[model samples]
Target: MEPDAPITIFGPDFPFAYDDWLTHPAGLGTVPDEALGTEVAIIGAGMAGMTAAYELMRMGLKPVVYEADRIGGRLRSEPFVEGEPEIAELGGMRFPISSRSFFHYVDTFGLRYSPFPNPLTEAAGSTVIDIGGQTLYARTLDDLPPIYREISEAWDSALERIAGFSGLQAAIAARDVTELKRRWNALVSQWDDRSFYDFLSTSTEFGSLTFRHRELFGQVGFGTGGWDSDFGNSMLEILRVVLTNCDTDQYLVVGGAEQVPHRLWTHAPQQITHWPAGTSLSSLHHGAPRAGVRSLRRLGPNRIEVTDRWGDTREFPAVIATCQAWLLSTEIDCDEALFSQDLWMALDRTRYMQSSKTFVMVDRPFWTDRDPVTGRDVLSMTLTDRLTRGTYLFDNGPDRPGVICLSYTWMSDSLKVLPHAVERRVELALAALRKIYPDLDIAEHIVGRPITVSWEDDPHFLGAFKGALPGHYRYNTRMYGHFHDQHTLPADEQGIFIAGDDVSFMPAWVEGAVQTGLNAVWGVMTHLGGRSHPDNPGPGDVYDALGPIDIGK
Candidate 1:
């Protein structure tokens, strides 16, 4: 990284330099002497919750973290067997390099990473696109037929026509907040009410081409795989992804993405305020977090009461809730008066997208071998229109066992096998792969039982992440702005806040979670009579001027 790295994840909606604010030498902020040793309740020990807790601990406050399950929430990586070292990444496997805030923690922990084997990238070695009863293999986009290249060109033209792709990206690279808001605010008004498919169909470039061109683009979309499942999502959601480069230059943590948060939980800041040099989040909690929070209610004047599942109740001056939004209504028995009716409406209306993954450990990296009949790989990283929407291959080493994500699907596709067991899911995937590679026997090489996860099926996480629909920008604004805007609310509601990717502009990205967590740090500090260093103003300081524009009623 450069000496002064520009934060690429600086929002198109809220253009705050979270990476810079976090890494600044001045530190996050300082709490009053009276507030020192004050306890803060952090519900759900996920990425956002953990980030806020860690930072708050640094400022001399004791953070009480509660978790329903393991330390890493959606960043789960389950080992294949009790004794085996290799594992399958059930969630958040691929991470984009442009997510500067997330990578900040990665570099801090001194963890290793490698390129994720996404479709059509050099790391994959080979990619196969199988659609409409036809199959083709490629080392790059140019290796495919002329029609595929034409579809790619059409998509590029469409983006350039509607989004001013080059200029907008230049602003992001330069961190020009003025030009960014001017252009992005205009887009929020025009595109907020439209769907991704609407953006594609209405573009003059795509309009000039045949319907088949659009269909082909959907099958082999840029970054990751087909995005047809996201056709129903708001156009603003898709634009934020491309504008922030969320889907490009992605890599996976060497062992698993879960290690990032785990390290944060145990990391001790060298120059922490109010605490001893060796004190860490783990030492503060006695090496174990509290049980899951079952209920939450306000106690007025910078006080909130939290009750764990085991009926252990505690009160704190400030609280940060990082669980999925839907969980507030369903799993946790939260009080009605903690927020306004409008806020509740926004939380209830937030839509979530479903996702599923199935994985199996193979004997070895056999897929990399060349076939006798054809001089190509025996099996390639695959994309298909079958039930198995996408298949990814992970090559551990020449001798070590390799792992294969047999099937990965989203939205409607994820629902198809949600009722089936892991074995059935693997069977369904292998059956689909047979059509793409008739001679290959994927099931025969499998050594152990398969592993799978349907995020929608998990009660704790009703769905994978928030996928806002058309006309839902108002709801998104209300949720994302709640922390800063809560100052106008009643005293009881002011100190209780929400943080997570679900409340951020760029949902599903780890950077969003980290940014919101930092926002909560600012909010909590200000509520407890603390202030950020004058040299480095926090998000709340710039929110009024730079926050997302409100599309008025």
Candidate 2:
């Protein structure tokens, strides 16, 4: 049977068939025997780094992974304690069903997942939308006020009218790159410079609604909190989220999402090249990864040298940097000429959004208790205009203790809590929630100390994830297309590649990290005289036609 076309989950602007590419049985590419035993230095042990190393291992290449902290990177699952049953997802928690690349490993590892409690999702037993000191409870959107309904309708109509939502979604579902690209490129030209707020404010459908209705829509979005914080961001970013159905039908990994990478570290699947059948990443590296990469420099043609924090150094025919882009200049001493001036500007200008989360352990699923007056759950997944922009409830089971993300704030709200202690952050969030659930003694059910994260405060990550500002499409295009530059760049720059969510068109999404990892794998394989099967071409194989929209020109 013929191979199927690549699925267009990310649209034409970032055309890459993640599902087809990941599920392909022929494998990504085959390296020659001479290149089989060669080593490839992979910086960072995050999703991208692990993924690339995993695929390359199958191709028979040795991958030496370097990690500054732990192996999981942003897919962090903070267990309450050693034997504690509960965990707080300090980094990536919920994932959309549409992320095929991310799920490939999840399914590969036999990990289980349950629906995430986001707003009106079935997993979310009840929802409480608190704004302007007024509180409302609902099971679905219909239970909300008529204004809320109207606003929701306006958004649907606006997407349909302005962006051809139906047509684009159908194209994406069909995996029609030609149609997806045409529609998305047109949108790129039209919306790249525009803000998400501009799209909402000027929409005829939304214009008919009252300003307060619009404000409510911004505060309590369909599945998340108010999107006002995203208003200043490029419309293309919002379009990508809606187009991909990223805000709904999501699931949380049962044990911990971090297990995906951890499993890959030791998993020895079939069809491996050089090593024996039982060879695993952990076994190959003696169950320990090298320390963080402190410097990267092009030493000679088609070769790069990496220096770790301990002054340890190694040379490889190729190197893939999976750390955050800013780390190249901020954390690592890299050769300036390794990347072009334009690419450097794009990397330096990459903007990451601030995000903070405070999670507390509870004695049980106490929130399931019914209210005397409203006849609804005493507490629910919350979205409010207060400091706690979004609050979530996680139930381990009726018998076990539950976890509650007391607060999930972003941007300005995240910055506000940067200086607060974890206990203080939890206290402040509980204080805000008290206004909505005054009768409920939320603090009484607390089981242990609270856990918190300020991603921006971490030197390695710098921030939560990339939030493309207006006119950032050009920069993103350059970064996403860096793999193809290997052919045009000087010989010294050919071996060093960049892969991570930050380097992908869809930053903040694990799928981006996975897809870019695959892309970099393809690039690295070819750099060592390997080639993908013609029938199963990699992203770079057809990148000229499916590359990102060049809005800068």
Q: Which candidate should be chosen as best, given TM-score against the real structure?
A: 1
Write one digit per residue (lDDT tens) for candidate 1, span 324-443: 998999999988888888899999998999999999999998999999878999999999889998999999898889999999999989999999999899989999999999998988
lDDT by residue (1-553, candidate 2, tens digit) is 1253222356557667767877788778888889997899999999999999999998999999999999999999999876665999999999988888888889988999999999977798889999998898889888888888888889999999999998888788777778989998999999988999899989999887788987998888787657887888999999988888877678999988889999999898877888898999999899999999898888888768899999998899999999999999899999998898888999999999899999999999999899888688999999999999899999888999999999998899999999999989988998999998899999999988899999999999999998899999999888888887798987766888899998987788888899889889999999999999887888889888788767656
| RMSD of each predicted structure | 1.6, 2.0
Off by over 4 Å in 1: 1-7, 82-84
Global lDDT of model 1: 0.89
Q: Estimate each model's TM-score.
A: 0.98, 0.97
In model 2, the Cα lDDT at residue 254 comes to 95
